[model samples]
Target: MNVLEFLDSPELTPGTFEGDTWEPWRAVLSGAFGLPMDKGRARLFKRLSGGRKAPTSRVRELLVLAGRRSAKSNTSAAVAVYLATIGAEMDGLLDKLKPGERGVVGLIAVDRAQAKVLFRYIEGIFDASPVLSKLVSKRGAESIDLNNRVSLEVHTNSFKAVRGRTMIAALLDEACFYADENSASPDVELYRAIVPSLATTGGLLIAISSPWARKGLMYQKWKKHYGKNSDVLVVQGGTQDFNPTIDPRVIKEALEDDPEGARSEWLGQFREDISDFMRRDVVEQAARVEPLELPPCADTRYFGFADPAGGGKDEFTMAIGHRDGERVVVDVVRGRRGTPAQIVEEYAALFKDYRVSRITSDRFAGSWPADEFKKHGITCDQSAKPKSQLYVDSLARFNSGQVEIPPEDKLITQFCNLERRTARGGRDSVDHPSGGHDDRANAVAGLLAEAATRPANIIFECLDDGYEPEWHPYQMFS
Candidate 1:
């Protein structure tokens, strides 16, 4: 019989099994292979579920790392349901919770809408299985309530929501997209919050997702912790490892259609989806190594930048630039929730630093930001277009391979986090979803805006016609 049948017996439970309660589940685990699942997966299930004596000491947490359409949703749903019903119907769930206390379990994701998908998967459990359907009411509980009332709840990628809750465990879906200061990567922060909640009860925190954007919390955790911890169960797989659900013919076409997309989704790596997204690598390739500091310029024809926020925190971005023959160098400054007057002052400081002749204000918030700048003796014109359109058009340089970028970590991070989605009219566009921070993207847009209009004149202070510059390389390079 399968796991469902094994869990039905009371004799297999504690005090009767002669061993830890976790041991009895292994026999049930061995039976999953009776189905049409991959033999490799069946073997893995046996290995992981073997003689489960008190779970892992250090690895109370479990992460199922797999590729797109790799049965993650089904696996996650089954696991959650299993915990809810196993051994006293989730009563023991609190016995080994993290932080050694009874606490709520958090199911966090990209946003409210995104979080609903996983919950829906879980709801299907009650519908599909005849045995489980009898035990659970026709309408399942809205939240992940256990048999005894302890439950799992969802919160969109809001750092504030995760901050105070006493979390026994957390199931992080699309963990790379959770909230940050300006991005949605809260690996450091979320772990900090989850640690205390699971301390007493020994809770498990499982972070599962198809890899995208390097350096986020999920990537960092996978890199630093994976093999080092023997207790944690990490199941990583590829599209090649899946069963009959995905057709081989379709996989071949998808791989051939967009090679980059396949690498990230199928291979479980962190990279961009160039197929649907306007390939920013096109711009990344054209970057040059310039000599100056703040903004690397093509040459010295300084122009102004204006990122006009709605004064209520809708958008905050700006870039001032100088061009040198198809080269665009930008120095960016940005802010949020500031009055139009305050923004004008910020731009005045930038104008002097950049020494620009023209300024483009992202006028979505409209006239107030630009008009406020006029009073401060800084003039800028309204750029009356959607930010998405401007971002896509600017990427022409990236697609053509004609931009230069620094090795700064945050800058590169934001660039990588930019995602592509299907837009109206059957076209694709690049954007950062609401869960992730977009400040770096704003800086990029500011840079791109300045690039759109190249200056006609060039000027540089006289240094030397005969003096030879020192030719030196860094110790790391040499």
Candidate 2:
């Protein structure tokens, strides 16, 4: 039976989907599978697809742009189940696999927790149907082995994990929000990896997510294919468009409070104020492949910066750098997760090793960072500029090829994931994306800005005593 027939059978998905609430999604799936639709659903299909005619044959790719609380995850689970069991058999996908090769149906999400939600839904759907339950030969935490050669698996947002797999189908839930510690564009990289796997099986690829910034793979696909008659079918709708059960008052209040955010969360529209801070190519150009960390030089003066955390989820990070001609060379960057006091003491010792007497940091814990560093004989000076300004200044350095960074994975990822947003007041701010950390990036930027802007020191020896005093030319005596 086809997916539409399975959804209509109460015995197959009993009490799982409401017909009225899921009508629009039903129309979407009908168009995706090239099934016939009624006049009403056909109109919705055309409207959502940018006035294009419904596909007469099954499309290889389907991109769904819908708002939050639109039941995207549940619908994705249902589609994955259908594709893994009946869809695979119908397309003879299992027969295409070589001997002893298992065909996989991958369910990918931004993180493991998010992926588990989709997995549980799939499990529940199978358990509700006695006929479908018999197909499960074995069950694991992240995978389900079917009696046929196909298996259902859960994955986080990483391209490496999906490589070398024989895939029958791949579903990317919340594809627009995919971020990784090692990749600037995790969704695009993961998509590139999955496409080849599906080539041998002539499988389906479905990506469903609420709209984000006008960037990344989801936005790009929507821009190129939403209203066109391309092989790839893209559809977009709001929360109420797909699920009318949601309260209108809630959406109204949300829109009143934050129009830009609410539009993306409730109206399925991309935000206009947000954009990427740095391009991947720019960040990669500043990184050196050899010498992950540089030792202190006897003749070079170093600048130190730290981003302190109170032994919580955030990491306490420190970066040491020095001037190399006109370039700001980051010598080393270290991050530790432990008691704040211990981390401060460890960083202080490292600072002294590099002959650094003073370090700069933002006023994170007020006088606490200063007091702690004093105990270790290191002077901690609060930076005059905020973290956002530091990032703004550092961007110029990156763009001008004046900053040299080590090939640190976390540092590169943090730099590439940073976002620059324009506020209502017409001010621009730079920082990491939501649910991301920038401890290392913050420290590096702070030190780079300091080193680049600091004036050169002039030293003079006292005539009477063999003592030398250093001073900046701009210094004035009272």
Candidate 3:
């Protein structure tokens, strides 16, 4: 049976996917599979597909941009199940696999927890259908092997792991939110990795996600293909456009609270205020290949900065740096998860080793960091600038190759993930992405800013009566 017939048949999907709520998704699937559509659905197909005619053959790629609670995950799960079972056999996709090779249907999400949501939906559809349930030959935590040498798998976003697999279809859940420390553009890299695997089987690539910033692969595809004719089908709609059952009051309240976020969440619009703070290549250009941490040099006059945490979800991080001619070189960056007192003590010892008696830090915990550091014979002074301004000041140094940072993964990842947001007052603020931490990045930025802006220190040595005095310009002004 066709995908629409399978979804509508009560004996096939049972109590699941009832009513006209799934009509929008059915139209999407119809356009994707080159199936015939009614006049109304044809209009929707054109509207969503950028006013282009429906394809005469199945599209190789599809991009879905819809609002939250728009049934993207469920619809994707259904499509994956369909492609794995009946569609594979009917379309001769299984014949493309080599001998003893099993075809895969990969459902990849930003993380394991998100992948489970799609996996559970797939499990529910199979459990609800007698015909599809019988096709499940074996089921594992992250995979389900079917009887037809085709398997449905759940995977977290990883470009390396998805390579070399023969896939009939690959669904990217929440493609806009994919982030990786090792990659500058995780979504694009992952797409590149999955495409080669699908080339062997003539498989489908479907990316369904809500709009984020006006960047990333989702935005790029939307900008290029939306409302224009292209081989790749791009569909975008608001919450109600896809699922009308959601209450209007919820979205209304959200709009009242945060208009930009609400529009992105419920109206399917990309946020204009958020953008990347620094590019990965820019950060890499300032990073040294070897020596992740430098030992304290007696000849160097170091400046230290700390970002303190209360031993909770956040980490207490410290960074030490010194000025090298016109450039700032980060000597060391340390992060620890423990009680604030113990962390402060450890940082104080490290500071003393570098002969750094004074350090700058954010206004985190106020007088607590000052008091704690004072106990260990180190002076902690609150920075005159905020974290956002510190990042702003460091941006030029990073872009101009005036800073050298150690190749630390967490530190580099945090720096790469930082977002520069423009406020209504026309002021720009830099910060890490939501649900991400940037203690290491914050400390490094603070120290780098201090090292760059502060005047060079002058030291004079008194020699014999007639000898000329020598001056050293290496220390930072306390």
Candidate 4:
């Protein structure tokens, strides 16, 4: 039977989909598989199709960009399970698989937590039906072996991890927010890796995620393929468009807190407020294979910068670097979470060991960082310029290869996710993306800025008369 019919089975799967709760998904699925949708659902499908016409033929690829808690994971899991169990029985699907070859299905997530959610959904669906359960030859912690020779695997979001697999179908959950480390862009790397593998098996690829930045594979596809009536179906909708159960009051509350973030998270709209500030190629070119843990060299004058969090949700981070000709080589990066007094004591000792008597900070908790550092006979100076200026100078250094950073994942991620927000008067500001922290990036940038401003390393100095600066770098939106 078709997937819609299977899900709508009254006796066997009655409560699987409540009345109209899954109608939008069912409509999309019916269009994808060339099944018939009721007139009401057909109209609903057209209105929410994001400009693509339903194909008379089968859909080989699909991209769904919807808001969070919109039941995207459940829909993706359902599709994955259906393809695993029923693809072999379908004429065109598993017929492409090589003889005696088990078709591989992948459910990939940005992290373990998301992977677990998808894994459990598939597991629960299989467990609900005895008929479907009989198809499992083996069940694993994050995978299942179907008697039909289809191997289902759950994976963290890494293209390298999924390379060389013969896939029947792959679902990329929350693909837009796939954090990047080594690669310039995780979504692009994953797409480049999985798309070629699927060609061999003539398999299906489905990427579903809430709209994030205007970059990455999801955004690129949305711009290029969406509403073009092509083989790849790209659909965009708000949370309520697909899942009507989401309360409007909850969305209102989110919008009240952060309009830009809320729009992308619940309104299913790509954010215009954020874009990548630093180029990935430049950042990657400067990263060392390992972070330097060496002590201060006798001849090298070290500079230190700290982003203290005082045992809060954010990290307390410090970066130390020294000048070498025109280039600044980051020597050490230390980060931890602890009580304010403890963190201050530990970092003070480290700074002293590096021969750093005075350090730069962002003025944490109004004199606490300075007062605490004073206890250890260390001077903490509030940064003269804004953090935004530090980032701007750091970007300039990176573009010129004037700075070398350690190959730290946290630092790389923070740098890669940094956003350049521009205002109406053409004033530009830089900061981390929504739900992203830049403590390490901030420390590193601050250190680079500190090194560049040294009298020995000054490249250019500009003094303006009668110029009033009202905005600090830290007051981004303000």
What is the TM-score of each predicted model, taking all chains together? 0.54, 0.93, 0.90, 0.80
Which number leads on TM-score?
2
lDDT string for model 4 (409-470, tens) is 77877887788986545688998764457888999988987886764432322123211112
| lDDT winner between candidates 1 and 3 | 3
Q: List the lowest-lDDT window of 10 residues for candidate 3.
A: 462-471
Tell me the spans in candidate 1 whose CA falls farther than 4 Å from its real position.
1-59, 87-91, 95-102, 126-147, 179-184, 224-229, 270-303, 307-316, 319-357, 361-478
The CA lDDT at 402 in model 3 is 90
Cα lDDT tens digits for candidate 1, 339-371: 657756776766655445346776555777666
Candidate 1 structure lDDT: 0.54
Best of the candidates, lDDT: 2
| Models sorted by TM-score, best on top | 2, 3, 4, 1
The alpha-carbon deviation from the true structure for residue 434 of candidate 2, after best TM-score superposition, in angstroms, is 1.8
Give the Å error, residue 459, model 1.
15
- Per-residue CA lDDT of model 2 for 24-73, tens digit only, reads 98889988989999899899889878888899888999999999999999
Minimal lDDT window, size 10, model 4: 460-469
Tell me the TM-score of model 4. 0.80
Which lDDT tens digits does candidate 3 get at residues 349-385? 8887777788988975588999999998888899998
